[model samples]
Target: MTDPCGACGARGCEELFHGLLALDHSRAEPWGPLHGVSVSCFLLQHPARLPADGGAAARGLLRAYLDGGLPAVDRLIGRARAANSHRVTGRSAPGGAVPPGREAPRGGFAVTVEEVAQDGTFPAAGFPDRVRAWAAATLEVWGPVSP
Candidate 1:
């Protein structure tokens, strides 16, 4: 088998991803608002899986959700979709480079998919709470986004 993911140290990321997808489809209601959170956290951890624009967008979306809840996240997503851009506004400066002040941490996040999975498998009771905590903790490691 392949080694664990370098970023998140997940042993079986593909399986985890599949589980996440199942949870997303099976528990859409509770998972809807928090889906972005989970996605952002995963993308941020596995930065190589994302391009520069995607990384910035993930950071921006996660920050917005932390600061303004669902409405803020929705607004950012709406704007990106409307503009046909893959970035979250204010997350990337021009040309898809992450702004200096908003860069991800040099090492890694304190929390990751492992922690989220610690609560149990996806679609299990209280899984949403684990994801919420993972998002919050991961964002905490990234610190506050600069304006």
Candidate 2:
């Protein structure tokens, strides 16, 4: 299905984006490398609040999804994906996956491994310092945004 929004069967992307829209401001984490592979971290935010127009669209989309609006957002997302892919380099961005043995994100298994960047491999002197640096960085980027 083709959509004006440019998605490609990635409901998680829309869900994450939608969650961002719900907040007044939001911050998304940078995708990081794990075991030599890039992995998306759980998105974090303060509170969902939106500007007037954005709020309206978010609400409408949320309602539609809750009301069984299927295939519609999928089309919009398709369009979005097409547009994004066209603009990006040949490398397709990796989407999220249900990591084996890890509980489903929606199944009360949402977890955040803070201070993970502090491992011995971290550029910092120690794990603690690296974790502090990571937290500081996260706050700096988010800038009081809900995400």
Best candidate (score: lDDT): 1
Q: Please, what are the lDDT tens digits per residue for candidate 1 over residues 12-88?
A: 66678667766776647666557777887887676667664646677777777767777888888887776665653
lDDT (Cα, 0-100) at 96 in candidate 2:
22
Candidate 1 wrongly placed segments (more than 4 Å): 1-4, 85-107
Query: Candidate 2 regions off by >4 Å?
Result: 1-49, 52-54, 75-147
Instruction: Determine which window of 10 residues in candidate 2 has minimal summed lDDT.
Output: 31-40
Question: TM-score of each candidate?
Answer: 0.72, 0.20
What is residue 56's positional error in candidate 2, in angstroms? 0.3
RMSD, every candidate, angstroms:
4.5, 18.4
lDDT of each: 0.66, 0.29
How close to the true structure is residue 32 of candidate 2, measured as C-alpha lDDT?
A: 19
